[model samples]
Target: MSYVGWMIFGVVLLVIEILTPTFFFLWFSIAAFLSGILAMFGLNLGWQVSVFAVASTLLVIFTRPIAKKIMGEAPRKVYVEELKNGVATVVQDIDSSKGTGIVKISGENWRALSVDPKKVIKKGEEVVIERIEGTTVYVRPIETEAKKEGEEI
Candidate 1:
């Protein structure tokens, strides 16, 4: 094919690649352009097809890893230390051994557990969130005696 024909094919494929965003079909288009280059060099149809197929396959295999590295890992949603040592009020009595209850923290109610399963906590009591397990917060009674005096309760 002529150089102008190959350039047109390349431009059309690139446009399709942009519209679809699949990262596929674009390779075959690139292959066609490469075959066009080979054709310009007077390669026959069979040789041109072979060169295109090999070049396209190599492009895909090599570009994929580079693309992933450039993109890096997918961004992960993170929950900060919002609950760590943060105080929560028990909204429901927690029987840790039986495994579930609710606590109200920062105006949001969350399922809770006693990090120490041996303890049973009562409703309306303040607790310290120890850790988060999935959506549930594990907690323990806040030590109040240390601040029982004039230390802000």
Candidate 2:
């Protein structure tokens, strides 16, 4: 293949990579680019194809694991749906006047605040998670929530 052909192949592969982004096309795109560079240096057609296959194979074998590790889904992030209406332990007094506190929800410490602005929750209290916005968990006193649920039943 001519230099221009290799370059076009590389560009097309890159575009496919952008469209799909499953890490499948990335190696091929890099290989195609390297092959194009080799073609520009007047390498033989057979050698160009060989370089492409070898480089692509090496890239997938070596870099794919590193990419997966770096992008690994470790611990993962908790969404609002996971925490809303859940229970939490107040680790620090939640003083709405000061606008800050801490709680342990699902074994993770999170900044917390009372759902009612005037409510002040003391440390060591169990609270019901009302909602979560950003890193803050808005909560209500557990007893009150329990009472309300009991009344509803």
Candidate 3:
């Protein structure tokens, strides 16, 4: 292809890169622009193609990881101890059989359910929060904690 063809491809690629950035095609667009420059200097078409391929590959290999580190997803971490064994008061009856309940912990109301399917926790009862799953608190009655202490899970 002519230098004008390469230049057109380069501009189109750049436009696409701007619209939806992946930190990927921008490098190839740069290679296309460079190939156009080489073509403008009267380099053979074969050399221009080779240059575009090598430059695009090298840029991706060297810079893609750096860009990903700068832009990659940062996942929020959850600590188990922050929720485990925390004491909570049942604000509404927790009937695991019906898959419903409510509790209050640290003055905040929360949807709750018993870990044991057969268990039903009564309102106003203090229960130990075994764990939190999303917005729901899984708990067991504190009175049942002795023989099942920690096994309150």
Candidate 4:
């Protein structure tokens, strides 16, 4: 292809890199730009393609690790087990039969279910996380002194 064609291909690859940044295509785009430069200097098709392949491989090998370190690690996965026994406030009434509830714990909201499905946990009440199954937390109401005394009675 002509130098113009290679340049246009480079630009297209660069646009793709910007849209879905995985650091993989950026190297190829740089290689494409390099190939375009070689084409401008009157290199034939075989030489341009060989240069593109070698340049892309070298860029990925030498630069990808540095780029990743500069960008930082991917987002950490939050495990529900870590939040076990943590206190949460009911944001929506929990009724297992109706499959409806929301709770706020440590500034994040999560779907919740009562440990005792028959017991309806009201909004604004505090609960202790008993366990988590999948994305929904199973919680039991926090036992207050008044409730303990009432229970004894």
lDDT of each: 0.82, 0.90, 0.88, 0.94
How far does residue 64 in candidate 3 sit from its true spot (Å)? 0.5
Q: If scored against the real structure, what TM-score would every candidate get?
A: 0.43, 0.49, 0.48, 0.56
lDDT of 3 by residue, 32-137 (tens): 9999999999999999999999999999999999998998775555454676799988888999888889898877788998989798888988999888888888
Q: What tens-digit string does per-residue lDDT give for candidate 2 at 37-127?
A: 9999999999999999999999999999887777665567777797889999999999888987999988889999998989999999999
Model 2 clash pairs are: none
- What's model 4's TM-score? 0.56
Per TM-score, the best of the predicted structures is 4
Query: Which residue ranges in model 3 land beyond 4 Å of their true spot?
Result: 74-153
Which 10-residue window in model 3 sums to the lowest lDDT?
74-83
Q: What number of clashing residue pairs does each candidate have, in the order they appear?
A: 0, 0, 0, 0
**Better-scoring candidate (TM-score), 2 or 4:** 4
Model 1 poorest 10 in a row by lDDT: 74-83
lDDT of 4 by residue, 24-142 (tens): 89999999999999999999999999999999999999999999998899877777778999999999999998999999988889999998989999999999999998889999999
